[model samples]
Target: MSSASFSEQSSDDPALDRIGPALSRLRRRTPASSKDLSRNLVLNVIADAPGETTVGGLAAEMGVAQPVASRTVAACIAEGLLRRTASQSDGRRTVLELTEHGETERSRFAAEQRRAFEEITATWSSEEQIQFACLLDRYGADATAWSRRQAASRD
Candidate 1:
């Protein structure tokens, strides 16, 4: 990677520092925990889902361990971010969905992410914006693929 690309990957980059600080500030301002955020997002998905959302499926989709998903789902149930009920189609299945409050938090989180992305993209030229977006998307997919490969190796 060129120095520009290296800068793009650098956590020490001033732009990243700014974004990090902003996120940190937002986290402190909100009554959200890592588990809460994860569960809230999952609940949002489940609400729109057409079928029962299993712990294992949520784990796979969220790229987390099944236990983590189960615990988060359980916690969300406690926090009222989600509700669980027996699946009518399958007595052994668990149904999950976002509560009203969870929908609010999900909306808030999405808005914050959009605002941050907008802020970062605002400084780029149109061509740079398109290239940067493509680069970022590739980076995300590559990172996910690499992580899954690493996890499989560990197993």
Candidate 2:
């Protein structure tokens, strides 16, 4: 089938109809530069990781290639935003950790994002905001679950 035919078949899919534009709008609204965004995301991931973070783990968690994660980690290390050390459980494995500067940067990034969200929803009613927040949280959880299932199936 032609690409146009495939598009026509799914054009009215409700999930796509709603989510596609919302994601586009969110991308347009985000204030951080793309480099800063990558930095912030990597930093946050390291901070929140349940176990020792590694370059490979960051790549998998972020859904990016190993090389991309490695480059980003290298830059962060150079900036003193992240530190790498031998894993306690496995000396051959390198573990990632957020430095104090990384923690501060992550917190600042989150605060800025929160401020942007507040500004965008300034006129929203309290109930509307609460409902939207809850739905967004649910959507995120559902998406993550779906992603994990797909990855497991592939393996």
Best TM-score among the predictions, by candidate number: 2
Maximum-lDDT candidate: 2
Per-residue lDDT of model 1, residues 1-155, tens digit only: 89888876795667765866864675455324665466556865576444677777678657788898888888777887777778889988876767788788677776766676667579778798778769867965676678667867877
Candidate 1 backbone collisions, by pair: none
Clashes of 2: 0
lDDT of 1 at 76: 78
What TM-score would every model get versus the actual structure? 0.54, 0.80
lDDT of 2 by residue, 17-96 (tens): 78878887886666579878889889977886667999998998789999999999999999989999999999999999
Worst 10 residues of 2 by lDDT: 23-32
Segments in model 1 whose C-alpha atoms lie over 4 Å from true places:
1-37, 44-50, 125-155
What are the clash counts of all predictions, listed in order?
Answer: 0, 0
lDDT of 1: 0.71
Give lDDT per model, in order.
0.71, 0.87
